[model samples]
Target: MDIEDTPVLDNHMHLDPIEGQNIDAVEDFESVGGTHLLVLNKPSWHLFDPASDEATFEEVFELTIEAAADASEVLPGRAWPVLGVHPGLISQLVDEGYTAAQARDIMQAGLDVAAEYVADGPALAIKSGRPHYDVSEDVWEASNAVMRHAFDLASEVGCAVQLHTEGSEDLTEITEWAQDEGLPPEQVVKHYSGGRLAGPIKSVIAEKDELEIAAELDEPFLMETDFIDDPDRPGAVLGPKTVPRRVRWMLEEGWEDAVRRAHVETPARVYGIDTEATLGR
Candidate 1:
């Protein structure tokens, strides 16, 4: 059997459009044995200026929707959409002289648009989180406020929320915030999560941390490459094929149940997907 036919899901990855890449991003990810992908929609930081106003937010809204659709087009039901304003971009807006109020308004509008897409179709989760340990209190608060908006929208739409935050943060506080927003802890997922932090509702475990995390936690967590879809940074955080490669390693290690949980079962449970139908295993 093809190693990829073993079934694996990449829970966190960026698969947006790029001008210079030679291969199709979706095809590349799938060619490596990826069965399902959760596509995050955000402009590459190095490629575009961060937005600060309503007009800019309108453009961002369209960009996010289009990127999600782009991935879905690649593999039909295989690519799940995760839409939200970039929290780092939120912080950047505030730092670039956009008033806190303006930033909040823009982010709120972006979340509104994202929520609409989720409510409509082809979208499954909301991704809104920022690095918490390295920002000023004011910037932190602004970022947190925007994140609250994301959680609120997730609650309203009944979709999972995928977090992108520092690994060492207090997940307890994050879970509490999710609770306050009326979102169950299980609906809150920490992306790039592992090591030294209490688990959230779910987490997207990095490839290197997979073994350590699988040993430490019993909860069903997802895996990711956090692929930026950048030609200049292929395999930057990790290549698109890393998740499948990790799955192969898991199989070699006799982690059959772990593979099923992270790749098939947990994703279905968290994102409301039909993994059995997708993988036919």
Candidate 2:
């Protein structure tokens, strides 16, 4: 299929209406042939005080859902929300005077709120993971507990999860956790993946080299820009156009079939959403 005919889906992206580009970024993505976006909620601290309660989390999720809804006006049924407490927020909570255990409890409560959003409709997945940075053993353990709670909530809601955590060559432990929680490992996407990780489905960054490596794997994978949508950072993780540009590049480089799998088949199967329908194929 021609690049224009192909459906380009960004598996993980964030849009901020307040301090960021908002729908303008979505317009940018659409201009470059982006067909769909999984718009995950930004961290709690980005929208409210670190010490905010569950009510604040509900507001954050509502903003995310609204952002996705607004994006659908641009792309029409191709923008979906993914809501959850950011794992790094545990650090923020601890810094705000809550103990590690208390932080875990708060994070878990936030996930509960996010899960309700998924169960009710607006969101297609939950986002959760441990801190990517180093922390005390207590905090580390607490983060893992919060992540596990996310898995449980995802299972109950029958939705996928997008994880943000330290990069690793092996994700066997994470896969096992999902399976134990009764959520299929394939439903757990490792966002910002480097490529070819051993477990949960990898949402490889849209870099050409990473996409090449992930395409070589036998397992299905998805692509993302992890676009932060910050006007100040201006393409921090990558630009809104990154995925579509990389997909076109891949097509030029003789990766048509891989592009179909990564952008269309994998996302449809993993999220249990109808990519073909959304693309009006």
Candidate 3:
């Protein structure tokens, strides 16, 4: 059986241009060991502060959903989208003479668009989170407020969330917020988690310590390459092939069950993409 037949699901990846290469990200992923992927558009973490054109937000929204739509032709049920305005973008909007509330409105607009795509089957999750550790406390608060609003929208739309965050200091608070908003903890996914408290589910870097924590988790979680796919930074975090390669070693170490939970079952439950069914499509 092909790796696609084994049904590897990449929980998080960016579909940025691979410099000087004619590459179809969807096909390349499946050619290795990726069957289902949650593709976040390249600028999902940037821009959004044009302060003049509504098309700025529209472009970010369309690019994400359209990528999934385009990928569906190659591997139906395999390309799931994770769309939403990132916290950094909201900060930029605020820096551009917009109040925090106004910034949130822009992000919420993007979420509404993402929710529509999720309803249409191209999007499976919303990606949003607070700022980094170095920003001012006020900026952090503003970012957190925007994130809360995004969570509210995600709850209303009944889609999963992919959070771009540093350490898990606020995991408990975030989880409480999700539950109170009627979004279950299971749907709140924190990206780049390691030494980070597991949030309902999380996508962690594919390092030994990270994988070890995931292997020993009392509950299931996701592992990822967080592959940027930039030519200048080829495999900055890890290459697209890394997840499959690591998983092979994990299996050798008797982590077959954990790997299966992360790669197949959890994704089906969280993202609603049927990995097994995507094969041979």
Candidate 4:
């Protein structure tokens, strides 16, 4: 298939209209042949106070939904919201004097609000995971508890989850957590993966080597830039145009089938959206 005919999607990304290059970044992606985005909510600290109540989460989710809506004006129906509590909030909560258990409760409450958004049709998926950095054991356990609650919420909403976590060779434990919660393992995506996960769907970053590794894997996987959309950190994880550019490279290198899976089929399956329709096929 021609590159123009393929639907290139960023499975996980963030857009901030207030402090970041919001819709302008979407235009950049479109200029480079990017077709879709899973616009995610930024962490609480990026938007407002970290230790605020559940109403604060409502505001964050609303901002994400609005961001996605604004992007849709550029990419039409291709941009979607993925809302949730950022796992790093656990550390911030603890530092602010809330106990680990209290932090877990707070995060779960945030997820509860996010789930309502998904169930009500504003968001396509939820974003949740344990802290990517090291922390005390109690905090770690609390983070896991929060993640499990995310899984349950996703199951209830019938949506996928994009996880942000530390690098690991094996993701079997997290996959089992999804299974125990009655959510399919494939619905739990390991965002920013290096393309070496044993279980859970891999949302591999669009670097060349990582994309190559993920292309060789038999299991279905997705691709992303994880673009933070921060002007100061310009292209921190990867640029908005990275996914489509790498997809063109994949096409030139004879990985058309992999491109189809990563850009079209996998996203259609994971997010339960019709990519062909989104691309106006």
Error of 3 at 156 (Å): 1.7
Off by over 4 Å in 1: 1-6, 20-23, 44-47, 54-77
lDDT of each residue in 25-93, candidate 3, tens digit only: 567665655656677765543333342244665676676566666666665355666877666776677
Every candidate's lDDT? 0.70, 0.87, 0.68, 0.88
Q: What TM-scores do the predictions have?
A: 0.87, 0.97, 0.86, 0.97
Shift of residue 136 alpha carbon in model 2, Å = 0.4
Pairs of colliding residues, candidate 3: none
Order candidates by lDDT, high to low: 4, 2, 1, 3
Instruction: Tell me the lDDT of model 4 at 60.
Output: 85
Off by over 4 Å in 2: none
CA lDDT for candidate 3: 0.68
Give the alpha carbon lDDT tens digit for every residue of 124-201 in model 4: 999999988889999999999999999999998899999988899798999899999989997999999987788788
lDDT measured at residue 265 in model 3 versus the true structure, 0 to 100:
82
Candidate 2 accuracy as lDDT: 0.87
The candidate that achieves the highest lDDT relative to the unseen native structure? 4
